[model samples]
Target: MKSPIAIRRGAVAAVFIDLQEEHRQDQRYLVDGYEKILANVQRLQAAARASGVPLHHWAYIVDLGAQDRPFHPVEADGKSAFSDKDDPLTAICHEVAPADGEALRIKAEASAFRSGPAAGELKARGIEWLVVAGVWTEACIDATVRDAVASGFRVLLVKDACGSGSAAMHQTAILNLANRLYGGAVTDTDGACRLLSGESVTVWQVEGSVPLRFTYENAARLYAEL
Candidate 1:
């Protein structure tokens, strides 16, 4: 069974991860339903601002001359597949771009907390819950959600606000995270906005260990329930 979660206005904040032009504009990296994901993120941003929830935006940018990770994908031209810091594609999407005074953090790694002060900063501000939304659900989004939970923060994962290269990848990633997302909850854009507004909302939460034993046949059914 799912649980009801109440997010206090001042104790919760919104986090947007890698909502950049690279994911939307680049054909190689564009996610399925990219436009719909951005629309949902925009809604979350507006709700966060109206409800006084602090918003932190993060973008992934590879250093121009820095040594690439062993597993980092490279194109035939020997350039990194991801955008470099100087690349115009590194810019955040204009629709959900951070407003003035909202800090835009650049991260070198998939998990924002791995290379930045995000964890400490959020803790310093007394933020106990994070409303997380962004792209590449199986990569950066998955990594960030696990780190946030391990770092002792409850996450309100915005499902519809996130996307991946394909619908199957996105749903599978969400299912994997949901199985192990202890102390956190998985919600869609509507439920997340309500929680951001200090409303009590019913969200999907793990009740037991490995409750969702995902298989190919059951994937669609499980994702639909989410």
Candidate 2:
């Protein structure tokens, strides 16, 4: 995988999938914290625009299975009890504009990298790096990152722009990722932008929120012939 040493005026772009009314309400509200991610999505949108990136270069709301069945909450004890009919998830797609050249792809699955036009689009443009954000940090976001890596694209998960039904799942998702497991890494929104901008830093310097760096030894142990 290749790294983005610096974000040019129009080279690197951020893609966010904002969950809306029906889609959010789907999945039995298992991915309950959709509202938590909106602000960061908006922030990233503004940043991408300021960086002169195109609208297609940014956000997408999952609209597949829309108008079919709405996501409904379930009583299951686990977080996956919710059912989304593309209802709540697509409801909160960012309000933005795009001309014909930009692409807003809809798909049948959670991870855009798996199918739809996302992979082909990225490859066609020679874009090999992705900065990802969305709800269900451990679900769709997590799935997409894994697929992207296997597809040969580098993924940087933006912490603040992603959320789960609770804090536990969110933190656990990040911890589970590190370099040790998913071959992916985590960073906050701003820090990711800085790194792509050639700021030359890994984890942020802040005290309470340093990203846990997974060592080569840790990765080796975790992935050892289990």
Instruction: Give me the candidate number with maximum lDDT.
Output: 1
Q: Write the per-residue lDDT of candidate 1 for residues 1-226, one digit (tens) a residue.
A: 5778798768898999999998877887888999999999999999999988889999988874685578777778666787766669989999999999999998888897775678998999899999999988999999999999989999888999999999899999999999998888998999998888888999999888989998999987897787
- Output the number of the TM-score-best candidate: 1
Error of 1 at 184 (Å): 0.6
Ten contiguous residues minimizing lDDT sum, candidate 2: 78-87
Q: Which pairs of residues clash in candidate 1, taking residues 3 or more apart in a chain or in different chains?
A: none
Give per-residue CA lDDT, model 2, range 1-226, as digits (tens): 1232344343455666434444355454545565656666666666665555544432334332353435633335322233333324443454432335656555445676776666776667766556777766677777777777788765666777777777667666655554332433456667665655446445411123323444544533332211
Compute the lDDT of residue 42 as modeled in candidate 2: 67
For candidate 1, the per-residue lDDT at 118 reads 82
